[model samples]
Target: MTRVLVTGAKGQLGSDLKELSVHLQNIKFTFIDIDELDITSTEAISDFFSGQVFDYLINSAAYTAVDKAESDKETAFQVNAEAINSLISVIRKSQTKFIHISTDYVFSGDHNIPYTEDFQVNPQSTYGKSKLKGEEYVLQYENGMIIRTAWLYSSYGQNFVKSILKKGREKEELKVVNDQLGSPTYSGHLAKAILDIINKDMDNSIPFKPEIFHFTNAGVCSWFDFALKIKELAYLPCRILPVSTEQYPLPAKRPAYSVLSKEKIISKYKINIPDWKTGLKDCLGKLGELR
Candidate 1:
């Protein structure tokens, strides 16, 4: 059996991975949140890896407070950048195949075309910079693969989808920025993609390559388009007012156009990426089940 260690087990993506692991007959998963493992401490990671070995390490843990990262630089860097070094050390020692999750924020959003993996990264925010640093650290290990996604949401965590549903149910009107462009990635889809890669590796169908890849739902849309779809899917009678980024200012600057190119990942893995509308519908349906 393939022994896998997933960090940030309670996170949206990590939770989805754990949920799917039940049906993976050939894989044995060990899930751990920060409470069970402090990834910032090298000693802790070294001690933990010394006891047991894992075939793969999926690092879904991250400091995702985008707006708060501006003021909380220390915590963000600790978790996003510095802590990654600790994981890298342990991954090297155990010869584990490392899979790290990154963000589309690494781009400056200055391009009119979709951002590709080889695009020059110029992150505009502290969060983006920190995540880029973490990507750099993981890339040092040739066995590690970095997957960058955008606008992630899931039933297990608080995200834009749930927030829109909640506010759409309570408020009569909601204003969403129309200038920001990206794709909404369902955590469940991403989790399945990750597992698919591991499965192929296990069967020797494809050799695991240490490279950066972009994984998001098929199409792109602005925040306004996303909100309208959310309200329609949830059957909520709420007016979604489209607004510009200038009208609503945030503490952290966001990418105006961060649509990632899926050409590379699609050709390499032969994965079928779902459309944004389809992904949203599936996520909302799962959310309804819980309520």
Candidate 2:
């Protein structure tokens, strides 16, 4: 069995990965949250990895508080950048296949076209810069895969979709930014992709080449459109008004156009990515079940 070490075990993506792992009998997963293993402490992580033999390290641990990262830059860098370097150090010694999860925030969103894997990155926020630093570390090793996703949400965590559902049910009206454009990635879908990568490698279905790839739901839309869909699907009688970025200011400046190109991942892995609308509906259905 392929042993996999999954960090951030309690996170939405990690939780989904764990839930999906039940079906993959050939893979053994060791899930660890920050509480169980402090990622920022190099000594702690180093000691933990020294005793275990893992074939793959799925690093989902990150500092994702976008606006809060502005004030807590130290913590953000420690978890997202410094800790990543520390983890890579241990993984290098263990000869583990590192799979680092990254974000679309690494771009400045100044382009009108979709961001390709080769696009020059220009992070505009502290969080983005820190994540970019982590990605840099992963690339320096040159033996792992880096997957960058955007607008991630799932039933297990606090996210835009959940926030919309909560507020839409509470308040009668809400204003969302229509200028910002990107793809929404459901954590469950991403988890499946991760497992599929491992399965493909085991079966020799596709030649495993470690490189940066973008994975998001197939289509793109503005935040306003996403919110409207959420409201509609959740059966919330909320009025969603379309607004500009300038109208609703945030501490962290978001990408105006950060839709990632999936051509690379799609062709390479031959994985069929669901559309944003379809993913959203499925997510809402899952949420409904929890309620």
Candidate 3:
């Protein structure tokens, strides 16, 4: 049986992957989080992987607090950068493949056009910088897929989608930024796509062009547009007021146009990405189950 180990087992993406584990065939899974596994501790990871032989390591662990990351860069680096390096050191020796989840924030987002794989990275946020380092660590291993996704959310964990639904119920109006652009990547959808890549065993012997590819549901919108759709779907009695980035400032800067092109990932994997709006509606229908 193929053994697949997923870090950040309790996160939005990890939780969704756990839910789907029931239907996966010929796989024994080990899902670990900070509690079960302290990835920051090199000794801990060295000891853990030393005894186990996992076919794949799906790394979902990260320091996701955008504003907090500005001040807590050390913590972010420990988890996002060092932790990844630790795992890569061990996994590089094994035949196991890696599927590292990354963010679109790694790019500068200055371009109004969709960001292709070859696009240069000039991250403006601490979170983005840390994640980029993690990407580099994963890329060191030739047999790995550093899947870069943006604006991720699911019917699980603390996420923008759930946060909006929660606040929308309490507030009469919500202010959202209209400047930043990206796609909403439902965690379940992204997880499924990654698993498909492993299951199909896509050959990378052919020199893959821009090994780093963008993944988001079809179509794109600004944060303001996303909030509006969420309110509409949930039927929340709240007015989503669109505003500029200046209206809502944070400690960490965000990409003004971080939209990424999915043409490569789609053509390679043939993934059928649903629109974020469609994903939101379905996820909202199960919001009660999320908590």
Note the clash tally of each candidate. 0, 0, 0
**Residue 23 in model 2: lDDT:** 92
With a 3 Å backbone cut-off (N, CA, C), the pairs that clash in candidate 1 are none
Q: How close is every model to the real structure, measured as TM-score?
A: 0.98, 0.97, 0.94
Q: After superposition, how far is residue 103 of candidate 1 from its true place, in Å?
A: 0.6
Worst 10 residues of 2 by lDDT: 282-291
Position 35, candidate 1: lDDT: 92
lDDT: worst 10-residue window of model 3: 201-210
The better-scoring model by TM-score among 2 and 3 is 2
lDDT by residue (tens digit), candidate 2, 126-161: 999999999999998856889999999997989999
Better of 2 and 3 by lDDT: 2
Output the lDDT of residue 188, model 1: 94
Which residue segments of model 3 deviate by more than 4 Å? 202-210, 288-291
Q: Which ten residues in a row have the lowest lDDT in candidate 1?
A: 282-291
Candidate 1 residue-wise lDDT at 23: 91
Model 2 per-residue lDDT at 180: 92
lDDT of each: 0.92, 0.90, 0.85
Total clashes in model 1, counting residue pairs 3 or more apart in sequence or in different chains: 0
